[model samples]
Target chain A: MLKDITIGQYFPGNSVIHRMDPRMKIVLSIAYIVMLFMAKGFSGLAVGVVFLAICYGVSHIPVSLILKSLKPVVPIILFTAVLNMFFVEGDPLFQWAFITITKQGLSTAALMSVRIVCLIAGTSLLTYTTSPIVLTDGIERLLSPLKKLHLPVHELAMMMTIALRFIPTLIEETDKIMSAQKARGADLESGGLVQRAKALVPILIPLFISAFRRADDLALAMECRCYRGGEGRTRMKQLKLTSRDIVGAIIVALTIVAIILLNIFFPLAIA
Target chain B: MAAITVEHLSHVYSQGTPFEKTAVDDVSLTIEEGEFVGVIGHTGSGKSTLIQHFNGLLKPTSGRILVEDRDMWADPKKIREFRFKVGLVFQYPEYQLFEETVAKDIAFGPSNMGLSPEEVQMRVQQAAQFVGLRADKLEKSPFELSGGQKRRVAIAGVMAMNPKVLILDEPTAGLDPRGRDKVLGEIKQYHKTQGNTVLLVSHSMEDIARYADRVLVMNKGKVAMFDTTENVFARSEELAAMGLAVPQVSRICRGLAARGLNIDPNCYTIEQAKQQLLALRAGKGADQNA
Candidate 1:
């Protein structure tokens, strides 16, 4: 049952986006998200799509895999699209007995759906190209400013890093536990709701106990190694932005500017 | 009846994806009832995947797993029954113990089988006894028990189901020498008393050699060899080449045999080696009568 989980998740690549400093990639991901939202019209949306596509291509993550990653969200996408199609006010596109779909609503829903898809695909590129450790390190560094605003950025990043590192380890542990229980005839599947949930108690209780034990061991080991909080911790591999990052940033900046220009010149198409 | 029969079993995880790799290639083997079979292989040689097929815990990407001549996936709904028929205690069994008390933990399995509350209690008690767990430890939380005790509780959880074919993957792993011996002894007793088929998967050839009557060797997802323990151990070189060692005693005998002393390299147990050495000594003494 646990084997269905995807691990060994970080795709190996040497593309331009992969070569960018993780810190830059993290920054660019946030910037791309901001652009996705600030995007005013279809033209702006098109720019975001084009830019994300370029990033995805540069990261060397197959477009098919990115689409596959979207599989879990297809239902949500459809729901949001249906809601948008019925709610937004504009010229009517089609009408059924009690339901009217507007032209404006259709366009808005299509644009919003595409935006959501691009946002996900763009972020996935970050996760796919950059290892979890680097991503967390980038997050910690980027959020360092918010540290003054009581964000606990360091702690959160540390948690994420530790959590990511232990994902495979805990997955392995869960696999062992599942096999052990399955061997004992713990019918994890093929039961009524309550029965199945009750069956999970055996698996969960043990996993929770071990998780706590692991946490304690980790804390003790950290103390033994004199690991203080992020106060003065020196990174073994410091982040450095390079020429590729500059080129990528310039290209992204130009795309955004062009999007804004198109929004001004062709305001009605966007409006 | 054959306890478990896997025919042309193959599994490729994440099939059609770039990450897809065959964890278990085409492999076929039959484990007969009341037999003690040892499965030895390197870490990724597919031992775990193979045993998983026995209980229908994992569906083979292709091929069939038969339990008592019935295909495990015949009904698909009967996989749970298959699990009860073929027990699998994975490595580090302690990771599966979650009940408040050892007693409840041991009872978890039989209860899942839709057994009566009373029958579940009986099986739990009997299984704990089978694994040499003390009556007093039954009330203690599984988390509070020592590693070895937790291990027994985990194993007892499965044994409570009273499976026809019991498969243990490294039952004594990470245990101290004494703990290892006790666990192994209890498992052997359980197998003997129940007269159940046993499949032991271990990296340590000594563990397999000591208890297993038959052995199956896996390499690169295929069966390298499968035969009586004696015959399998005879190919010590091939096993060694696969990074699997022979039983320590058999290995020692081989070294002695290389020094011009006549002996059987097929003896896997220490007792057999000791008896052979004594017989040779007696023969040498009788030769002086000439």
Candidate 2:
């Protein structure tokens, strides 16, 4: 059951997007998120959606995965959409007891839903195409300038790398513990809220104990290997921007510029 | 009656995804009640997956698992009850211990069975005793105990449930030779006194040779062989072809036989080897008199 979580999930591939520099991918993903918010109407949001679709195509990620990434955000999308539909005041389309639907509300809801979907899809693309280690390395390199400010960017990235590395291990451990407890007749399902929370005691305590033990072992092993933080560390796979990354950067930059221009030149029809 | 019956069992992990792979495929086997069966397989050969089905920990994708003639997934709601009937001690089970005191950790299983408090307490004491955990150690926190002791506590926790069928996956893995023998010996004694079906999953051929009445060999998610221990070890060539070996005694006996010694190549245990060599010496003395 714990295997269903899709955190830091990287789909192995040799596509153009997969080959693009991780730093550029992270930067462009942030740019894409910004473009989604910058988009003022359907016209601007449409550009963002089109750019994301093009990315999905280039990355060779299946459409099913794109839909899967959007599953978790469906509640948020519905929430904002429903709130906007009922709360916004514009041309009234329907009325029922104190609830009213407005044409402007409908338009806003549509725009918000599209923006949120595009927002998640765009960022998840980054994770899907880039491995966690490479992604952390990119972030560490990108944030290296902050070392001048006495920031512990290397340590932060190292922690992220370790956390990502152990996610599958911890997940497997949790699965084992759950099965062990289940075999002991622990009823994890079909209980009152209090009973359910109480049942988690067995699973959680063991999970925490095992996780801490693993962390302790990792620290010892790292020390044994002479790992003294990331100071003066040389990477074997250096993040160098290739022509593909340059082209990706240009496309993302052009998309953001286009969204801004679309917002300025073509406002919503209602306005 | 069979303690557990698997019919055409097939399990696919992460089904329908690109990562989907069949871990167990179209396998069927029946384990008679009160039988000590040893399961051997290479890593990722479906040994774990197949046993998980015995206790309803995993539902087969396209098959049925019957525990004492009852379909495990018949109700799905009562599957937890079946767990009490068939206990599974996972690999590195010591990591599953959570209660503050060793006694409480042992009681976790019996208490979960919804037995009376007195019954739970009694079972805890009996289980701890069975696993050779001393009375004084029961009150101490399980975490304070050594690794082997903690593992004993974990096994006792399952034993406290008094499951009719006990399945342990690599119970003695990562233990020293003495610790390994101690744990296996305790389990063998438990099986003897309880007269319950026990499925022992181990990588050690010698352990199986010593304790298991029947050995089930799995290869590439299918049952390779299921027969008496003597018969399984007798076919060392077939076993070696599947990346497995018979016990060291059997190999040594085979070496002796190849060198023209009157040794039984089928002997799989040190006791059997000694008896065979002694009898051979007596025969040699008789031949000299003739």
Query: For this target, which candidate reaches the highest lDDT against the unseen true structure?
Result: 2
Q: Lowest summed-lDDT stretch of 10 residues in model 2 chain A?
A: A262-271
Model 1 pairs in collision = none
Candidate 2 ranges with C-alpha deviation above 4 Å = A90-102, A268-270, B283-290
Report the error of model 2 at residue A40, Å: 3.4
- Candidate 1, residue A250: the lDDT equals 85
Candidate 1 runs further than 4 Å off = A1-10, A69-85, A90-103, A148-151, B262-265, B280-290
lDDT per residue for candidate 1 within B186-272, as digits (tens), equals 989998999999888887788888898999999989999999989999998898899988888988998988888878867889999
Residue A76 of candidate 2: its Cα lDDT?
A: 99
Name the lDDT of candidate 1.
Answer: 0.85
lDDT per residue for candidate 2 within A1-271, as digits (tens), equals 7889878869889999999899999999988888888988888889988888988998899989888988989999999999999999988999999999999899988888888888888889999999999999999999999999999999999999999999999998888888889988889987899999999999999999989989999999999999998788887887788998898889888988998899889986444
- Determine the TM-score of chain B of model 1: 0.97
Kindly provide the TM-score of model 2 when superposed on the true structure, using C-alpha atoms.
Answer: 0.94
TM-score for each model: 0.90, 0.94
In candidate 1 the C-alpha lDDT for residue B216 amounts to 93
Against the native complex, each candidate's DockQ, computed on alpha carbons, is 0.73, 0.84
